[model samples]
Target: MHSKFKFFLFALTLYFPFTVWSHTPSDSISTEQDITPVLINAYFSQQPILGLTSSAQTINTRFLEAQQTTTLLPAVNTVAGVRMEERSPGSYRLAMRGSLIRSPFGIRNAKIYIDDLPLTDAGGNTYLNLLDPAGIHAIHIIKGPDGSLYGANSGGVINIQPEGFDVSQNQTSLLLSGGSFGLFQEQLSIQRKVDNNYNFSVDQSFTRSDGYRDNTKLHKKTLQTAHRWQYTPKNDLRFFALYSNLGYRTPGGLTRDQMEENPRMSRPAAGPNPSAKAQQAGIYNKTFYGGITHRAQLHPKLSHTVSIFGSNTDFENPFITNYEYRKENNLGLRTYFSYENIDHPQVKWQMQLGFEGQKGWYKIDNYDNEQGVSTDPQAKDNLDNIQHSFFYRAMINLYTRWTIEGSIGLNQSKIAYNHRFPEITNASGRINFGGIWMPRIATSYRVHKRLALRGSVSKGYSPPTIAEVRPSNQTINSELKAETGTNYEIGGRIETANRRLIVDLSMYHYQMDNGIVQQRNDRAEDYYRNAGEIKQQGIETSVWTYVLVPNRQRFIQALNVHSSASYNHYRFGNYEVAEQDFSGNKVTAVPDWVWTNTVLMSFPKQFGLNLSHNFTSAMPLNDENSVFSEKFHLLQAKGTWMWSLKNKRQLQIFAGIDNLLNERYSLGNDINAFGNRFFNPAPTRNYYGGMKIVL
Candidate 1:
């Protein structure tokens, strides 16, 4: 039924406009008008957004830029329950909601995207390694579960939207910078619309650095291209593509003494060991990912998008040990369209339908003593895995402010083995249904023109990922179930008399049943099982006010302070570990309190400064305090200046320092790469500068 309906819509849209009166060319708008709106669609929703169900919990781009953060992690870290980690500046890992240890193989939790195209790898890790944060125009994190819309991995979702094009203006921007740890970055982007209907956009970026430790170094490059064709007054078609390559080296983790005394040290071994064997000391890796996306406007306010993406990742352990991974491949396809035809004054309705699928395989090989050794026999049944999935979702909007969303999915996955292991089979996979209903009803009585009381409640659920189903060893033993939860939040937004005071407060109570947790198996003793009931309740608040407002002639215009705070209580259910009675044990890594405050001083036409302070409560690095991670505060600052000559030319300067205090702090447990070290060494202190030109 859905397929037939989709076809009908397509046919109707293809017919010449002789019979369609509602279709209007987007270009009909005055060409002199600013194109910022079309390029950044999500921003139109200023206050608590209610339109795009994808990001009911809004975090505007301006709010992020205010922090002077260069990556997605820093900008998103302040959101309650969302934690992002970086072993160094080159690697980033993120987890949303409860601190659950997702599987390390094949698409784990969390669905990620770069400009509507999936960025998730087979191992469930997002390919943030290749991204240059400066290229992003806006990002919206749906917070909580989004499995209903995007199939598989429900740990919460992040949607990134890039800049589009302008039909009336030919614009270009460039930025270059050098920072601590031998880091250097460059970015260039250009977009222009020709005539009144065709537009082109291009972007390129490169980054390289010596890194913070004994073996941390990274190099990356990216190129992006996009074309928009307004076929007619009523129809538009767009094409976009991205190419990214990344290379990095990591010095293995060290013991407690090695971490505290000399934070810049590394083990260089392939596995956990204190020995100085050069074979296992460090590792080098290279990865590449690229994809294409297409979007078409079928009718007024109705559009469809389709994308195809793939990646190849390779890594080698240059340590004394000859462990290595030659390559892993992933391919994905996605399609979705939304219809927003709420043109009626008395009643309104909107509908959204989407489907997504990913197919991929991974290989891990044991190498001979030599560097690039390969054995023909061992490569046959090779350590390989395939993950395939499909989902169907629908969201209906009744009236302007009410929404209900639901989705069901089919998942089939397996790990391949040689004939040597007849005991290993791939029939244990299972299918599941997951999604959320975020019904937001905000009645703005309007206290004058800028303030109102806004309240909302949202329910979210995340399903287990492909890796969780098939651990390192695949079998039929107790298959784990997806952890399902709800995020109930109530919040109010305030806009003051002078329009300079912006305040937001929100309280959330989260609960999960049969959540996926790591538990010591009673039978195997050392092996682990997935089982648990968990709860996390927290409150988040933010205040952004302007201490100074600049005038047209002054250029030094606004001084704003933004602060947010959160307190979360996380604990296990009636469960025990190591035969110890442990009913009230706190989960590892999920801190009890976290907060961040940023002050931004902006000069409309000249320069700007941003300073931020962040704090995280002491968290048990391991289950016991023996490996406790102490709490610490980190400070950062950045400045930007713009210069212009006369017509058609402009230059912008940017510089910043991260870890300005050089505060040594651990980013908390992410993947437990270093089993026992409570803290992962942060960079000492580094400063960087860059310049951008627009033509």
Candidate 2:
């Protein structure tokens, strides 16, 4: 047996003695809540989960806290067909369905919103890692293309609800945690429901870690606040603000041989390229983002909502080839008007019209990197981007069992750049992507009291991001085109009458043209190109159940299980590069199968246990499909004990282990990397322990 597993078993023996010490039978049944149906705002419909005409999933706070509190990867990965990865402590990448192609790092080809505010900028980029996990109360995900409601996406949409919106009582919490690799984290949160008409929440967090690999270190601090006010009987106002300062070192990638020799080593120095440590490769960012929204009911059948948001960021990155700095500013607005016939019971209908727009200004400068110091200037540029979309949606229900909906959107985008250093003729140039129309139709029918079926056909469109247009190589690509696709999907939901068991299944086929692909040069600099065509088909399913109800006399007070799985058949079509044809090749970076399972057990005396397992199949690393990555399994476990205090206060302590099987794998890999340097090994077996106090 592995030494780590032996130590973990010994620790469990010491803890089992404590579990036997039970509390009074009159105490609370269990800290875990029963699995119940909840209302969701999917496709602008505020209805129960069973009435949706789209593939959707929701993640709550309890599920998030069951794993590590420092990162959202574990919680988000519980959703089928969704993948989130972290190359290092503070670096994050997210993908919905098979949209991972265009993204080398960060979030792309997807739309993200916090409440009604757009978190993704006009240039189609999202800084998802900046937000602390404690500040998020819930997440709602809509699978497949949703361009009719949200603008410009091929991957889907994610809406995050902050802490204050769901608070039912006033509470303050402080959490402190420490784990392997010199990891330390602290978070303080305060949520107050000031009377019945107003509520607010504040969250502050700081985290630092000396990572498992050489030259990989991370530190971040964040402050977030949210406020909601029912100023009048028919009007409501909401505001949210966040500030974050983050810095992390990049360890780079290693070859297969190098990894086998020493997975803990950073990228070694090649002929002309310096090692990651010698070059001081890292990324630093200081950003501030905020937004406000107002919702009013003009009349019984009419309503309106408007939101305004803005953000400013100062970013610095030092790589082996160059040192780059960027200053970015963005502002946007979203407003919608709705008309509904709520008074009629036999037949109901609704119509909505909305507009979303955003503009961004950016300044970028590159200099020679002399071990992280800025030396002679290399390149400089000023760029501006503007994007907008107008959309309309209509829905009708015949009786309360059948729903039909249709929607359309018109989008336009343009970019202008002025080259400053090493200038040439027409130093200023503009690229305008003409107007495009996206449409969607969907329907859902409740066959019986416990079953429902739904189907949808939607169009997907996504333009190249700013980083893709002018990649690290510092060259502009004027010939690149936007990616467009159409998706056909069918899904069903089944639930037990008591809401104790629920299952969701969905299947989709997406055909895309002008697919964006990421590439790297011999110098390890990134670039982008367009693939001719691609085809993707997949099936996703999830299950949630409560196997045992809470009982005071039972040793196992409650038992809950949640599982999700995905099967993908993704391949290239009519794709050719130079002299090589990749037609019928498997899509790079996407696995053929992925499965995740989680089990939660609640015992007497407010004691809880959680176990999670994830399995991923092998995937291709390059477009040619000549090289592949190995499959791996991950196991994680956590245990918690809570005690009630005076004045309705509480104290909790938790300890957890990740990668209990001591697997060797990469959480994030550099796909299609230069010189076959693809692997970035994840941490080995690790452990964490934390304490929290609530008042």
Candidate 3:
């Protein structure tokens, strides 16, 4: 028997009954006393999820509190087509639908927004780690190429909403947690409503950890506030601001032999490469971002919304190779006018027209590293980027059973750079990508009262990010073209009459041309090139149900189960490099199968237990499919007790264990490494205990 098959069978047997979980969340929490029916709402408007023509999901505060609150890694992984990894304490990588091929560290090929403000810059990069998890109240994901509305993305879109944005509640909370590996966290949140038309929220948090590996300590502090005012019956205004200071050590990747010898050791010297410990590899970053939005009702059926935002970042990185410093400034605007006729006797229609634009200025300098200090100058570059998109969308509902939607966007971008140190090409040239059109059409039909079917066709276009054009190798490649693809999808949703059982299924195929790929030179410096083509196809499904309802006579008050799975068959096409053809090989760094499950049980005396398990299959490490990582299973458990105090106060305590199986694995691996230095071992079994006070 094959070892992979045997291991898969063993894992399935170990956690089959305890593995069901759901990503779509209800508006209210489900406790021992309250079992509200699950209601999935749309992000754009007050509509039901089943009526939408696209694949979407939401994770609310209840789902976030189920996992360790220090990071969003576990909670985000529950979505079938999404993957998030934490290489070290503060480093993060995320992908949607196998989009990780172009991302080395941060988030790329996707668009991210905090409410109406853009988190992704004009250069097509997102620093996802800057936002603390405590300030994030909910996450909504559109799980395909949504460029027709968001612009310049092949992966998808993620919108992070702060607390009190969608709710009208006054509350104050404090949370403290301590865990293994010398981890500690403190957070405070305040939400207040002044009168019926004004509300505000403030969130502050601090976190520190001594990681499991050498030179991997981390600490971060963040403060965020939001305000909303309905000054008049026809006008609304909103403001958001954030500040974050973060610092973390970088324990570089290790080879298989080095990992087996000592998993806790930092990257060691090989050939001309210096040891990570000797170089004191680390990163430090400080950033500030703020935005304001206004909306007004122009007529009975017309409305207008506008938002303006700006940000600044000071970033420093001391690596084994060099010391890097960068200062970035960004500003952007988004405005739209919407018209609706939803009260029609037979047909309901709506249309939206919008324009979004952003500009950025960046100064980057590199110098020789002398024990984490900047010394001899190596290179200095100044660059600026401009991006804009005009888009429109229309949707119609016929007879309240059939719906159709269409959207189109035209995007343009330009980049100019100056090589200041070499005094060569000093702002003399610019790269312009002419206007590109992205369009999407989708339809949904209600076959029955409890069933709906949806289909969509869309186009995707993503230009090379700034990092890809001028990577660590410090070379500018102007010939690289943007990657483009067309995606086709079909999906369905089913629900029971009582809403106790719900299921969603989808399948998609995408053919991409001029795909961007990453490579490392002999000196272990990163570069990029274009692959000819790629073929991506996948199937995703999710199920959520309640096995038992709340009962007074039974010890188990309630039991809820949820499960989701993904099967991917991704391959390279027409890919040839240096006389080697990898056209038929499997895609690098993407697993063939991924499954997640979770179970929640409520007991007497306000005690509840939650258990979750994740299984990931082996995946190829390089384009040639020569080597693969090991398959692993992860198990987690948490128990909580709550008490209702006097004066409408509540106290809750939680303790949790992660990696219950203690299996060895790498959550994030360096693909196509120079010397097979790919593995970055994840943490072992750990425990955490925390308490929350709510008033």
Candidate 4:
């Protein structure tokens, strides 16, 4: 493995070699001075990554739109090492610093995006309920691997940007919601700027939720429309069209004594009691996505951007003893070019060169006759597969504080089955390189101006996917190869110059070689091989800030505290699971200890108050299992009010309570919080309310 990844980078350059450094974020305001907004939403001097840095207690989208919660895994489980693993109610799954939270798939190692693209499915599943935060304006999380854009099995990356229309014409909004399982939601929006160079917006959303269990269920529909045109002063043309139709119902998995006796039970029980009935292990799916981007400026350092994104996925199931129907079709194309120069004084340049390609054509069908019939078979799409990839990148600007970035890529993929599953036709290729150095003398000044006793050392990479190479009604051997990973991060972050006492931290030591695990085959007990030599190391910390300064509540002006927290540690070297004895052990649904805490108090406006909490420590139910669940916590709260009836326009009313101490957790499928738990129950203390309008 390349002389053990170059002797593990020669033992982290003999232990942190003064933690590297190099700059370009305009010397980052002369070395950090209390800057918040979650490091301006995870670094953005117009997008591009390398040795990236972010902290101000991370978690900012106005602190996740202050509890407008519908996704983002429950406002990022309220920070502090994060946690959210529900499999019902607007679908959920995401866990980092602890690695794929013990895998039940979906939310695959973190990789979700709306603007920066990527919405994974086919291998790296991502289900944040297909995203819909009513045109969210910002949210950027690079998290792991210093976030060099994306590639491979992305360890973590969730960038979303919406809400644009500069000129700001009459601006409009409307929202209505109904509560308690059988819940309903609606949102409508409009923003304009015609002529003055042009800008536009049109939005839509529909939501539904029911049953705390039984077969937990939900429904969603969303559409986004955008347009921006400016031709003249440097040319610009941007247009985006998005459509999302999500259908749900997949409540299955549990056995650790039925998730500890009943974390809201469900099986065929008509999935989440909507009058209970069905439950033959039902499954439903529908998805569609679209994209477009173009920006141009021939002069001034040269500029260019071109994009094309596409998705078409469909799945419908009645059960599955082998298969009934499952489909996937995807297409992606991207092109880019940018170069901004600073004629050398301290040397300034922000360069980007790009090209990306993705294609997936999936299938599954076998009710051709009978086995576990549902009596309605007349479908044929025997299945066909195809995969592809292409990439190129760069970053450089040495001297004046120093900075360097690198990229060399080639990922060719192929899978064929023109007819008789041609032994599952397969073809592959791999090549990757990563680099980052911000070493212009590791900073010794500005430890107080908002903190920066400075330090850095970064390098990250990921590659390997195609449903991990032929998996779904399995049988292997088509020459599999490609599962490369490498990451080494030394971190530091803390800021508060009027951004409220903030603190952010990082500590990593990762190493991976020929790592593509899932080896065990008593003649097919879970196949998809490329095994051995897998060792994992971890430690990630986060603590958010903003204790008070929110508008005062109506008549009781006194109660304000907004907080966030985190802590995680994990390990496993030789590896082993399900046949127990954990070999080197320490990996069985991840949780050596994880944490989450959120507290917000308000009452000076008539409505506006919140208190939330989350924590995870003992986890390990199967794979010989450590079996020590029963140490989960969750509590929630919210309130809001504002009004001005008649002609003028304005009205708001809100209320909340979710798991308000109804503490019951289930991540992956640990079989705990219920009778045997494998997920279900993360909603016991439930209460909701809403009302809104402004014109």
Tell me each candidate's RMSD, in Å, in order.
12.0, 3.8, 2.9, 26.1
CA lDDT of each prediction against the hidden true structure: 0.54, 0.87, 0.83, 0.51
Worst 10 residues of 4 by lDDT: 18-27
Q: What TM-score number comes out for model 1?
A: 0.78
Ranking by lDDT: 2, 3, 1, 4
Query: How do the residues 1-695 of candidate 2 rate in per-residue lDDT, one tens digit apiece?
Result: 57677567545433321111112112356444454576676766557888789888888777778889999999888889999989888899898987466765599878999999999997889999999998998889889998988999988999998898757889999999999999999999999999899999999999999998998899999999999999999999999999999999999989999989999999989989998888889889999999999999999999999999999999999998899998999999999999999677968999999999999998889999998898999998888999899999999987889999999999888999999987788888999988899999999999986799999999999998888887888887778899899999999999988778889999999998998988899888889988978898999999877777566678998767777889999999998989999999999899999888777777866888887778889899899998788898777889889888999888888999998878899868887899999988999999999898899
For model 3, the stretches where C-alpha displacement exceeds 4 angstroms are 1-43, 425-427
Name the lDDT of candidate 3: 0.83
Off by over 4 Å in 2: 1-35
TM-scores, all candidates, are: 0.78, 0.96, 0.95, 0.30
Q: Candidate 1: minimum summed lDDT over ten consecutive residues — where?
A: 16-25
- Kindly list the per-residue Cα lDDT of model 4 for residues 1-695, writing each as its tens digit: 25565355334323321100111111111123233343334322543122243222234434454564465565766544445665676656676554443243355556566664566643445655666776666566655543344544435566666665343555677778777777788888786777788887787888878657766567778888777788778877666666677766656655555556775665422232221124244445666776767677887887877767777767655432333465777777666677778887666656565655566676655352132345543333333333333444454554533345444444344444332333333322221222222111112123354554334333333333444444433443355554444555555555566655555556555554444444333211234444333455555555444433333332433232334444434444554444544445454456665544454444533344545455567766533454655666554556656565676566777767666555566655532122333444455556777776767
The digit string of per-residue lDDT tens for model 3 on 1-695 reads: 35676476447535443432221112223434433343443324646777678787787777788888889888888888998888889888998987566776588778999888889998888888888787887888888887888878987889888875654677888999999999999999998987789998899999999998998999999999999899999999999999999999988888888888888888888898888888889889899999999999999899999999999999998888888898989999999999999788579999999999999998888899887888998888877889889999999999888999999999888888878885664444588877899999999998987789999999988888888877777777777788889999999998887667789999999888898988887666789889878898999998877777557567887777778889999899999999999998998888999888877777777777878888899998888888788998888888888877898788888889888767778867887888888888888888999898888
Instruction: Give the true-structure RMSD of model 4.
Output: 26.1
Clashes of 2: 0
Where in model 1 is the C-alpha error above 4 Å? 1-70, 78-81, 103-108, 121-123, 165-168, 268-277, 280-304, 315-322, 368-478, 497-499, 517-528, 552-556, 603-605, 668-675
